[model samples]
Target chain A: MKKILILVVVALLSATGYGYYLFQKPSKDIATTKPYLSTIAPQLIAKFGSGQTSSSSELLSKVIQVSGKVTDIEKGKESIIIVLNEGIKCEIILDKNPPFVKGDYLTVKGIFSGFDDMFNEISLTKCYIVL
Target chain B: MKNKLLIMLITITVFGAFAQNKKVTRTGSVQFLSKTPIENIAAQNNQVASILLVNEKQIAFNVLMKSFKFEKALMEEHFNEKYVHSNKFPAAKFKGSIPPSVALDKAHNYEGVEINGQMLFHGVKKPLIIIANIEVKEDLSISFSSSFNLKLEDYDIKVPSLVKDKISEQIKISVATNYK
Candidate 1:
């Protein structure tokens, strides 16, 4: 009976450890994420033109892949911003610079946050350069 | 009628040339920090859009709430879902004019000014007065920096009793931008 009780306790401890591991798992990589920029940009522009603020509900908070020419690069104190196609912008929250430079075609995967009403721009966050 | 058309053309061309003096940047940055006894929380947003109307001494900035990135994923989620409710209030904006006391000519190069503006954030509009440094580069680029502090409660951000110690009552916000 004592041996059986010890085995049960060990099993319960392992189960809890596994649960914690799953709970603290990092987010999935952007390469595995879906929905490319070609589809998202037009939708965002359409919504902006129509004066609709709540149109892209399906894309919000979801990791998406976006590709475009780097029109401008903005260096921040802590991060970098890559503006694409004039209106679509991604915020890369990292100390290091991305591999590409301005005018280079690149693709990145990031979380689509929402639109900027004052600037009429689509905003994404926590971006990772995929290409 | 022909002379009137010619005069209108010249006027449009002159206005277009004058408007070219405006400097704009879509990738400005704004960072905020919250300090408390238990922890310090900081988030930075790089997708800040700023326009400097050099001719008018007016500046405007727009930043999306969802663009702010936090170090911890869980904390970021909590900020968007619980505190900011980013889906409801999408963006923050400021429209201000540089004080006339500061000069922006080539002779001055740099000036310190108090920008009096209206800030719109979290579905509320408040009057904001921020002191900032502006440098006009030889290349015609403008560099700006400002820091200000504000209470979270002023924007209707509520802190739960469970993690009250982890969050600060007043947060420090900094804005830095380079426009061309």
Candidate 2:
């Protein structure tokens, strides 16, 4: 009976521990995660710019790797935004600041948020510089 | 010589009008707060974008639901997957115009500007009037800010009874954008 009680107590404690861990789980680190697909910045920008709103929803939340030349870099309070090819906006949320300067050819992996018609640019979040 | 001068004057006028009429930005900020005794949840998205048509006194904002990052992963997941169904709709947008009475050409601080427009969210389009404080600087860059409250039921966002009490029905939204 004592052994059974000890086993029950351990199981209950472990269940609570696992629940706590899940509740405190951090956002997905897409930098190390394998990308769904790869493409260049201009091509992605063109597709989304042509009023292909449906495709944006399809790619939403999926990690993608995009390569382009950095055109503008806007450093915000929380993260660094590297504009690619004068179009795509890759926001580095997890990694606060990246060392890449303007005109540097680079590759980033991040979750595709979607196209913003206001600016006509593709948006990425939780971006991590891969190359 | 007179004709050439007239042509030059026309060209200058067109170019100056084009340069001063529009301003846009991609790093606009939008924040939402849900306060209840059980929890006070707030999320801000700096990735949002806005456009200011100074000539027409028109303003519009676009923000992806997935862009709003919450402090807790579970909360973010629930917000995207269940609460908003963001994958289907992806974004909430507002396309509206400022009152015609305000002079947009001159640089001045305009307060309590009523923006009348339609807000499209959760695939539902509803008429929304946002009160904003707009500052038009000498350079023609605009600093626009507004805060408003929205009821979850107004947009057909139904929270299940299981967590209904925890989440407030009235969600406060704030927007700040600098158009350059």
TM per candidate comes to 0.79, 0.86
Winning candidate number (DockQ): 2
lDDT of 2 by residue, B1-180 (tens): 999999999999999888778777777889999999998889989887777887788888898888888888899989998888887777899988998887777789999989899999998999999999988789767788999998899998999999877899999999988776
User: What's every prediction's RMSD, in angstroms?
Assistant: 4.4, 3.1
* Candidate 1, superposed: residue stretches over 4 Å from native: A1-40, A47-52, A67-82, A92-106, A129-131, B1-16, B107-112
Residue B86 CA displacement from its true place in model 2, Å: 0.7
What tens-digit string does per-residue lDDT give for candidate 1 at A83-131?
A: 7776777877677777778888877788887776565667777788777
lDDT of 1 by residue, B1-180 (tens): 999999999999998767656777767889999998778899888778888887688999988887787766677778888998877787889999897765554535554578999988788889999988888777666789999987888888899999899999999999999876
> Per-residue lDDT tens digits of candidate 2, residues A22-111?
989987777578889799988887777554477767788789899999999876546778899988898886444567789999999988
Q: Write down the C-alpha DockQ for each prediction.
A: 0.41, 0.57
